[model samples]
Target: MGEHPRRRADAQRNRDRLVAAASAVIAEAGPEASLEEVARRAGVGSATLHRHFSSRAELLEAVLHDRVRTLCALADELLTAPGAGTALVTWLRAVVAHAATTRGLGPALTGYASDPRFSPHTMIREAARQLLARAHREGSVAPNATVDDVLRLANGISLAVDSLADATECADALITLVTDGLLRRPANG
Candidate 1:
């Protein structure tokens, strides 16, 4: 069933405002940030926020969806970068940078159990699979390390360093740590 034209337009506008507001609030204060503040910032009433999101969990999920779409696009960009190791590291850096930008996103995305048909987790796994496969083929990553392992490691780094003052530094350290752990040592000359 289709809605009246005006009603559909209003709904679309509301969705845009809600998404913008949620992104702002979530970036500022994490997923647990105030819903009312989001509504207020969006220049809409709390009732309207609830009308659009229905609940805090729903808003959080939507914000995550928005972020994942951007992140996956970045992963696509990394696919064309030179060197599998460089591309993998570049992707990891980008992922961590994104995680730092969106407070609580790492945890929210990791915990949300959306259906695979619409699940960002599944998309994320596919992205990881591509990069990890390439890194393995290039002999820069461990042969036994699965996409799931890389994701878990990345998620753990994001969660652990989420609140640090120097999250970028922490993320770099974690990435280097993981990379060193995963790479094989060169034979002595």
Candidate 2:
């Protein structure tokens, strides 16, 4: 016989609560945030958290998955934004800031880039590619600019951001410098 509808609905609710709690906790405490706190915040017991996520890694993947979805959604929305250059710049800043603030996210993303459960790299790459293509068409970005070039550059900057005393400013400054140079010059130039 199939599982009871009420029981299934309850299970889904618990899972949703756990993920929401985990997102907030992870944002505050980084990737190593305590699972116990996640459970408490979600109003679920430890056993329930364990039942939903077999291990810390599993829970981390879920949180990371949500972050990846958010980033991609932003990219998709920016595709139709008023200015292609502005959209590209905004999305790139968001990507860099996300990596900078989310301590351990870079390493986790690298380790799991190929994992379907958390394919941040692949998804972000496609999103960036679309943005870049739009910018190129508008003559704002260099036509030859590839997604690999920008992502690699941004990834390197985020890694460097780890040691800087002021990470957000550093990320923005560095991205601005690079973008200013990478963009196309005006007719007068």
Candidate 3:
């Protein structure tokens, strides 16, 4: 028998729900967590989770795509802020804060070795490139800095923070120091 139209739509909804819930859960639990656990957290059947993600790597990739989109949107919105320095600072701080909470992102998607097209990472990089270019042109960021360099530094900071047992202060300090280095300096200095 043909599947009912309502049934197909409901299945799609279940898939979307599973994807979103799995993203959050995996960010906390890492990619090795059981699919049944993900399903339970998502309030969906294990079969439903499998239908959407198929495998752990697929779910991880989907989560990275979602996060990349979110970060890119944040960069786009921040780029239009009243002050360029303020915008850069705000975005950097947001990245650090986001990094502190989200596991595996530093190593998986944001690193220099990772493929830019790995998930929606290219979009995020392009967004960062545009913002960093503007920040440089506007004399808000260091002239010689590339977006890749910034991301590398951010990834390094995120990794360092991730290792500390109680690193809230350390994370904040490191992010602030990096932000200071990223700032533009006057020619006369």
Best by TM-score: 2
lDDT digits (tens) for residues 53-78 of candidate 1: 76676787777787788778877887
Model 2: per-residue Cα lDDT over 85-109, one tens digit each: 8899899999988787677744553
List runs of model 3 lying over 4 Å from the truth.
Answer: 1-9, 97-102, 105-121, 165-170, 180-189
lDDT of 3 at 182: 67
Tens digits of per-residue lDDT, candidate 3, 1-189, equal: 999999999988787777778777765666565678878878998887778866666676666666667788889998788777677667766676667656664454333343445645467568778778878879977798888887787767777888665554577788787766667778995
Error of 3 at 150 (Å): 1.3
User: Each prediction's Cα lDDT score?
Assistant: 0.79, 0.84, 0.72
Off by over 4 Å in 1: 1-10, 101-116, 139-145, 176-189
Which pairs of residues clash in candidate 1, taking residues 3 or more apart in a chain or in different chains?
Answer: none
Clashing pairs in 2: none
